[model samples]
Target chain A: MTTNDFLPAAAPVARLIQALHKLPGVGAKTAQRLTYYLVRMPEEEARALAEAIIAVKEQIILCSLCQNLTEQDPCPICTDPTRDRTTICVLEEPLDVLAIERTRCYAGLYHVLHGVISPMNGIGAEELKIRELLMRLNGGTVQELVLATNPNLEGEATAMYIHRLVSPLVPKITRLARGLPVGGDLEYADLITLTRAFQGRQAL
Target chain B: MTKPRTINTEAIVLRAAELGEADRLLTLLTPAHGKLHATARGVRKTTSKLGGHLDLLTRSALTLSYGNQGTGLATVTGAEALDSFMSLKADLRALSKALYLGELADTFHPLEAPNPPAYTSFLEALQALESPADHDLVLRSFELRLLDLCGFLPQLARCVQCEEPVLPGGHFLSPAAGGVLCPACKPSYGDALPISVDALKVVRYLAANSLSSSLLVNVRLPLHRELAALMSSLLRYTLERELRSTAFLRAIAQQWPKAEDVPSRTA
Candidate 1:
């Protein structure tokens, strides 16, 4: 939704600019600049961009099992039997799956919560994929559930809540180990993370 | 060329929602500025220095530069976290209450309106919750004070319609009428919740007394129910809408039953 009627140029170009403005981080001026740039583009690139956006809207469906955005029903990872079916690493967003996948840390399946329970922003557990995750857990094949939500208040709250909801029904539930990031200055670290690192210290 | 207006305030991060690809829209409740929404650019990226200091429930001193036009969302140029309340990190119950306090403040206070009273109450409330104080009392006191400050202080001792003093016994609370109603006038309102005199006294005590002092009032379980119901209806009547945080908080309350036994630091 256009907030406070920010854009009012009335042309199709203005509509494009407003649409871009609605997106996160794109300021009004930047939105206009991008729109004008897109108008000047040699037709195929612009058509391709438009079609790609349309294709995502028309083709992408939430994976029935994991709730990750994909073109297929169960998504590739959920359908793969070779993957470690023993664990399910839960995340706050589809992007988080990519972030963890890049680390090549584990071969477990994934569950995307889509959003955290943040009431200040009107998000709740009912609005997320927690119920689907619970249904997935009911199959009993999953043993270890890793809560890998972002290290923020809402993320932590979501993790705690789901942990409460799923702990009784499952064998074990785990959270990503908190510690100092590599190459980080210890002095600059926030007290919370630093303290967590100390509390969960490891033997070298 | 004239420079744009810049505002500086010490504020707590009430809430943070994603604004754009890599930015956040923050609701900051400040002593002088009340609750203001500012845009922290590039905050979603780990490289963004401003991101860490703006975590939920963190209080920080901020310098916001209203962009050239001196309109729309202000840009957060500088931030220094005064306190991160790290104690709340592990305790999920405390975290929920802390978040509730933030959302409660955000809900009642208006944008850019200076409400030092509400701001002070909010900061104190956060500190109390972070202390893992009796959340029920903390929340009740905060709600009472918030109502008093926002000009929604419900009348306690008198009847809304008859203008007679309500005796110290079970009475009807007419939120629409903005106070307690004596039995004589109870039939005048379509919406009235039964509230005990003890509950009214507690609300009056909370309204008249400072939050820290009001926390000392030991409300029994039955009175607890009465006070909560009365205040919620009062809040809904005054705010004209249900506060979303209360529901979220209730969910957390159900999750952690032992939250009631959480030791108060002051106690």
Candidate 2:
């Protein structure tokens, strides 16, 4: 039975349950369990949780430069002087920006498109933050654009499309290398992956 | 609780939406089930084996098990790509039109309904799109044929107003009124667009003939515009929503003028 079937949980508790269930992957059972857990939690801890949610809602905004969510308009990364400014890495989502940041190798600025082009899903170039990326190129400061979209059909298509649109404005454009996985067997690789791996083979 | 049943079917990926963190919600158009929406667990992860086969516009044989949790969502257990439509994927313009056709099929075809005619229409439309040809003409023919197959064929054979036989001449096409109107009924629907006899004839021909024969038929620039306008109006009335791909296609058409600027068809 659904958590709602528990006969109209107290208004506040029911609201909290609904809010929890709205989060991704949180089903009815998990929502009810979490609500009860919160009820049992110390008053200070629960207040801290509510306060953290409120703070995030109040403080978080997209950085004016990279479009990444942050408390400040310019964000810490955008204000950092140690990062390379000559190159910019473009990605489909803010999550990708985080993924790349975790690698700790790349030190360039980033431009988040917020989404890739997917015609089947009715998402197009107009829907993305591509114009913001283009506007960042106006100063003739950034020399290279590293397209880091996923290695799938929609991602490839999006990269290619942005490349065409921005090629005239930039000096060089590069794409994330596509090849076979590190631990995968060659025998099991699909035709497209195998072909890309073969075509992109590097010399020792 | 007893586990839900699992079944297999051949299908094409019409749309894929990200779900949870690593899974995808796939809208698959199938022959037996019409339009199906299922969750492919872990598909967004690179390590997932089913990722490649479930991409948008790719056809695959899918094994799906109904969710016993009463979520009304099925889980894709396994899948294999049957047709990749590689060339269409490579070209931007072709890809746009192909995806437009997919969106149209998804919109016009209802969920959980087994409509073989609409299903086969989709199959043939994708096949027709795979070949190199006039992308717009191919799309128009696909739209008209899909409309015909879906039983939304506008009453073109006669006056939709009075059911009078329309002669092979000038007539008005009305979206709200549903089809071609004679001069007598034309004045009533002021919004009715003028449709030349030749344009209506070509549209009828495209709808009735096989994709190959439709490709062979030559439509002059003027006739082509009329046909395109008529079909677009018919589609807007039937679906009542704008096709998303049209904007992207319009952008490309504006950039590459000659390829999209329709004149007369060769042969």
Candidate 3:
């Protein structure tokens, strides 16, 4: 039996529970817990959370240049002068841009495709931001294109498709190296990962 | 209360979709259990042990556990890759064909029903795709085999209408009637497609031989197109909807050079 079978919540409370249940990982019980918590929360805090959500929806827009979510036209990364303008790292989502930025290892621009090419899901190259990426390379300023899509099958297919289309435009095209995880044990490594690590071995 | 049953089986990762934040819902095809929909928790995380093994189109050995009287979705507890088909995944054209095969197998085979022949045909097709053989021929042979296994094989030996022997001449294949219609019966079936004598012969040959034997028969461009269209029509009729991968296969086929045009290499 569900929580509602025990006691019927108020219309507003039930409505809130239904809305929360639509989220990615929230289930019926979790939604009810959140709903009851909201009922007990102070008005000021609840209003603040609601207003923050609205602000995010209203103010944020895709950056015209790199297609990353940003408040301004060209994101700060695209306009940053200290960053190398000769290289661009192509990624599958905006979150990936933040992941790479956290590393602080590479200083280059980024392009977000927003998704990978998955035929099973009815997603093709045309569905992604590929045409925009090609247009970005037409200026002839970029020299290296790094494909940082995930190492899964769909990601690899997307990278291959983009590489075939953009190879003539960019002088150097490279894909992210696949290997064993940093903290994982070598004995636990899968064969594919081990083979790739061997083939992509670096010289000391 | 009895404990949940744990079963180990070899499976092909046919389709996968995101579940919660870090989980993946996979559609796997197995020889013993047919198709299974299971959820792999934390598979999207970088440190996941099951992530690399459960990629789409990869065949792997899986350990699945069922609870609540086996009505709920199975949970994947362990996974190890058997054949990743690396070469096929590296080439876009071949990858498209392999995915189509996976989708076709997923469509024809029902869940919880043991179908070893269907499963074996799909595995063989994936293996054949990794070789330097003709990819289209492999697909044609797989389609015929799958259609036969599913009891949807088009009547090539005789006319579907009158049940008479199909003579050696131009005939029409009727997807609606589920077979070829002789010229005398073609006017009765409006949905029939014109099939040349050679095309009929090729289709018959594919149905009669194994996938490896089918690869030995070299087909020119026109006959290849005819067989593709005929098989596509039969599949569309059987499934009642065009598969998403069909369009991708056609789009990529147009971009690549014809198989006949590429000179064969001899040792």
Candidate 4:
């Protein structure tokens, strides 16, 4: 067939665009742009990108204890000796462990639930890494659970769900905090803060 | 040392945000109090002891030292969990719903109030969620009961304008006017949306009982729709706008298979 006759009828490109659009926060236009970008990328770069996708599925295994995606069956965080054995910080995703670590804070080990409890969305407590978390606590070395889920709705709910389930098993459970962002301005604060500011008023 | 306030109450973790370099703040829903904010000092530290005990959705018996701060904040002294709700985190659908409810609770309930009934209602809702039996009904019951506690009861048993006993028939829910309207009263109500008789039955049933009761498990789709409609109307009436989480809830509910019917592929 001639090159003109064999010209791509947008189907292959359209499929790529559709796939990109399905990703979190990627709109259709951005997906289209990304698809076009990929189509023009160097052959080596394209091969590398494709290989990376294959590699994740090929190499990534869940940490046996925490259920987090890891190259090793027992992730480095779970295996590290210096990490606290008496406490575990439960998170919704593996990336959250990274977020806490970025702050240069937290020496305790981690457990990734992979998700949170959400009844309206049809998720319950049984689908998470909670059973494994409980099992880890059974040894009695773990004394506390720190819920490091996101600050949003699902994050808070997941933390509470874990707390309720583990309260009887673990002696201590705690959550993250909220406040005015560092360097944030008073003029930009919303009612939640305006209320906090009023409630935490200072005496003249 | 003074004895810390050792209280036993079921709490919903509402929100968590980072504080100072090594501290975290939490909003909790207590069984004896509506909502409260507590501080976990040094919780962000590498060696902080309170880290795991402070996450969201964890129901715990807390030992709090009521801080004398001008803000009336409670400092978490000790914590022990009662249930982990592990099932919720494993499934995406359940996870989304739990988060949506947490958002709703955080939005509607005030932070400082000694509202024991509100606390109990929330606990019952969470427990109902721990299993697969009638989750939709549990949520609907919780919403209706919450509105009732907040002084926004739906006019389920009778017509809004005529005051006549509402019978099974074509009905419309008017959020602006507040409650359902019979066929005769629909036009006069100005903005009533269509509702089925079954929905009204569910609404009335939910409105009549405590959320913890078994009556919730009896609800089916028709009743589910009705309770949802009624709650939508009531919340719109009270808040004067729609909650952002309502859309998410609707989206998730659409993904759920019809009652007693599994997806063909799964089956």
**Candidate with best TM-score:** 3
Query: What lDDT tens digits, residue by residue, belong to model 1 across residues A149-196?
Result: 887788877887788778766787888876666766666566666677
DockQ of each: 0.33, 0.27, 0.40, 0.03
Single-chain TM-score of chain A, each candidate: 0.94, 0.90, 0.94, 0.84
Clashing residue pair totals per candidate (backbone < 3 A): 4, 0, 0, 60
lDDT of 1 by residue, B16-103 (tens): 8787688888888889877888999987775556777789999888999986667778889988778888767456677777776777
Candidate 3, residues A23-135, lDDT tens digits: the string is 87888888889989988999999999999999999999998889999988898989999999999999999999989999999999999999998877678788999999999
Superposition error at B266 for model 2 (Å): 31
Better of 2 and 4 by DockQ: 2
Cα misplacement distance, residue A200 of candidate 4 (Å)? 43
* Candidate 1 Cα misplacement greater than 4 A, ranges: A1-15, A18-21, B1-8, B63-74, B260-267
Residues B133-152 of candidate 4: C-alpha lDDT, one tens digit per residue: 67777777777777787777
- Residue B118 error, candidate 4, Å: 1.7
Ranking by lDDT: 3, 1, 2, 4
Clashing pairs in 1: A24-B19, A24-B20, A24-B21, A25-B20
Global lDDT scores for all candidate models: 0.81, 0.80, 0.87, 0.68
TM-score, prediction 2: 0.90
Best candidate, lDDT-wise? Answer: 3
What proportion of the true contacts does each candidate reproduce? 0.34, 0.26, 0.38, 0.03
TM-score of chain B of 1: 0.91
Model 1 lDDT at residue B60: 88
| Reference-based TM-score of each model | 0.88, 0.90, 0.93, 0.54
